[model samples]
Target: MRGSFRIEGHAIASEDGMIAAANGLMPDSLKFPSDQKLYEQALDQAAVIANGRLSYEGQLNSPRRKRLVLTRSVSGLAPDPKNPNARLWNPAGESLEAACAALGVTGGEIAVVGGPFVFSLFLGIGYDAFHLSHAPGVRLPGGVPVFHEQGSGRSPEDVLAAAGLKPGPVQRLDDGVTMVEWTRAA
Candidate 1:
């Protein structure tokens, strides 16, 4: 609440691998076009990071957020070409602790936002805080699960607590929809 922190969450139906499916990683389904705006914001955020609009660089140049995008198809367009961000290293070679240190965000708030797989990586690497939305879950028969085999090694909440995040008030939107906010454990 005082400084920068790592952020992680999911969207059930992103075409670009950033969105989640209808049934989330948890086990229940959300009540589908409801979270459309939220996904739009996610794309907007991705654009800002991709366009080098975040963080200070003597003149506010680009995303120095140490981004590690997780995607099955790595042939997409490059977001930040100035070397502000690094390509994802999948399950290994991209340690969160090391990245945090390199980005000078240690002891400060570190953010991690993406699909379930990425959250699992962060969880394995010890990241806290999960700000997720409860949307109407949809089922994709051949869809991928939120956490991968390697990601499933640890509990996300455990990593979050160790990393300084804890459960907070749940903000439910409309009637059944809700936005759950978590913070670093103190």
Candidate 2:
């Protein structure tokens, strides 16, 4: 945990490592009821959700959670103009601790939901754990990857492992979907 907060990343991707299609939209092929159930349960436990604007807007239930929207438009941290329950944060200007303090977040899990950039950001910041769910046989050749470096030939698992995270047991969530939790190596 970093300063009383545990950071966790959550994402569902296609087998080819794509989280969204080329248009920056998650295709239905990657969505599974069981996977979403688990995802929602995790969000329910988070102190605050963090993500890029695209990731936030893609979720219908985003308004239900206290969140941090990563954006360069904000100088540091400011009340989110679109959602009263959120803050627009510019990591380049302010640290996550300062942003969390502004949001009145004392301590708990900071769930990092994402667009590729956001995911890549936390991978560098370090995650206590990352829950990755994948849909087999689904492939988005030119889609947005789970990590920006994936385009340079690194798989999501490769990226995570390189960041010092080790995968736990994989669990099948549905017919063609499976989930795994990767934790930071000791």
Candidate 3:
């Protein structure tokens, strides 16, 4: 089964290489009002692959949620055997390819909404598109950077470009935020 992958990153890129605050939580200042709607739309008809931390701390933790896969490096933690829509993956023991197979996910978009590590992982695997929303005039001084290499002096755009993604036209969102779509180069 051929699956398409896309990543969504919200808010301004931080100076530090972190997706959340030092406390591992997303702060209010960086959040945009429209992010919730965008996230809902992305998750509407697609399966979601998210980092373990995010899965637990974010909205994916809702007991009623379905079609969600959480990837973690730790052992002894597996997806509920009874829930076909939820899956737990140990990347160290199993390959992402294998995990996808077990999840029975095929032929639909997989939204990789992440922390930096998750984003970094998919960056190497490649993406069909990346939806990046930046909140203007906001900067996270000690907050995490959107890309892993951002701390190394490489911008997120540079990283995407290096991965063969081409930027599309910019679209405006609420509160001075701008969203850009980056698609893989043909």
Best by lDDT: 2
Q: Which stretches of candidate 3 lie over 4 Å from their true place?
A: 1-18, 55-77, 80-84
| Native-referenced Cα lDDT, model 2 | 0.89
lDDT of each prediction vs. the true structure? 0.42, 0.89, 0.61
Off by over 4 Å in 1: 1-66, 70-84, 87-91, 100-107, 149-167, 174-176, 182-186
Q: Write the per-residue lDDT of candidate 2 for residues 113-137, one digit (tens) a residue.
A: 9988889989888999999999988
Query: What is candidate 3's lDDT per residue for 107-175, written digit by digit as tens?
Result: 356666676776777777777887777666665566666667676677677877888889999888776
How does candidate 1 fare on TM-score?
0.46
Worst 10 residues of 1 by lDDT: 47-56
Better of 2 and 3 by lDDT: 2
For candidate 2, the TM-score is 0.95
* All models, RMSD in angstroms: 9.0, 1.5, 3.6
Candidate 1 vs candidate 2, TM-score winner: 2
Could you tell me the C-alpha RMSD of candidate 1 in Å?
9.0
Off by over 4 Å in 2: 57-61
